[model samples]
Target: MPVPDAPVTGAHRETPEPPGGDRPSRLDPAIAARLRRTPDGLVAAVVRQHDSGEVLMVAWMDDEALHRTLTTGRATYWSRSRREYWVKGATSGHHQYVRSVALDCDGDAVLVSVDQVGAACHTGHRTCFFTELPVSSGEVAS
Candidate 1:
């Protein structure tokens, strides 16, 4: 089955226009080629819960992770700290089933809508970002 939210041919895949009418080109062949040529072409991902507006996770994507995510319709990420591939919710049963994937104007980041199961954090929290640092206070607290 085709992955949900995967871009279909003829669909409007244009990147959003920036302020002052400055808009980068969408993920065309040329841009895709350039991305492939980069040493770390993969970008950031924003994983949101499909039913709720809750953000389940934010992860980084490498080329392999992107490919796997597109092919499998599941969230896949490159673990920079671990130096390996991480299929979200794979081990913990907190899988994120992709609903859609969008690229930013510069193609440097991605937003993913997904059907999240269980918790998105290994720490048993619902989200990977469990702690919030007070911006004004500059204090780190969970």
Candidate 2:
């Protein structure tokens, strides 16, 4: 079935041209159609550990990637550099199984809760925030 030219809130109306075609029927038409993307065609997804509430990583998600994640029950993101869709744990043994997703007030950012297995950071760390930046007081956050 041909997807309708629905009205999308914030920014221009997406042509409903999801990368892999129409979004799965399981996803609400209104909610799935309302995804807001930057001019560069991306939104921010913040991944956090479901149990410990520790931040795992932040990644970009275009409309298609977001749909992929919602439909597949896995954390999927758009690779800005590589220009591709990547499913978490596709390559590495580390995988983030989506537990819940929360949209920010602006609806542009998302907080994804996941049952993470192995390391969340590609560098083999539990989280990507292992490094701390020094504050104006010349003291780093502990």
Candidate 3:
């Protein structure tokens, strides 16, 4: 599928209120049609710092979570372990103010650009990817 350069919500029509209890999705049909969900019905969300291009964290998002993020301009994710929806910064003061959101060419992942404040990791790291893996080359790849 040839994905548009525009964000998924760029031309989305306002739908009824988001999904209620146990409801699967309230995502716009157009957007939903473009997604390629996992067996558990989710897409990977890669969050990054807008200005610095620093990857902050990775999370999952179901259709409803995506809808809430798009509509609210906050980073909302489906907590796989917790099995619930959580908006970033809701509990922690570390907030991700959304700058933009775009689906990958494969429709299986999304890139969320945001103005991140405070720690973006559960361990209080600025980013979730703190530990660097040992590389055989030990040199930056050009």
Candidate 1 residue-wise lDDT, 43-88, digit = tens: 7888888778788778887655676687789887765554456777
Off by over 4 Å in 3: 1-22, 138-142
Q: Which candidate is the best by lDDT?
A: 3
With candidate 2 superimposed using the best TM-score fit, by how many Å does residue 2's alpha carbon deviate from the native? 43
Off by over 4 Å in 1: 1-31, 34-39, 135-142
Residue 76 alpha-carbon offset, candidate 3, angstroms: 0.4
lDDT of 3 by residue, 54-138 (tens): 9999999888889989999998887655556778887667788999999999999999999997888877888889999986867
lDDT of 2 by residue, 1-142 (tens): 2221121223232353345433233446676556676766677999999999999999988766776688788888766554556777776768889999888888789899999988888778889899998867676778
lDDT of 1: 0.64
In terms of lDDT, model 3 sits at 0.80
Better of 2 and 3 by lDDT: 3
RMSD list, candidates in order:
12.1, 10.3, 10.3
lDDT of 2 at 114: 97
CA lDDT, every prediction?
0.64, 0.73, 0.80
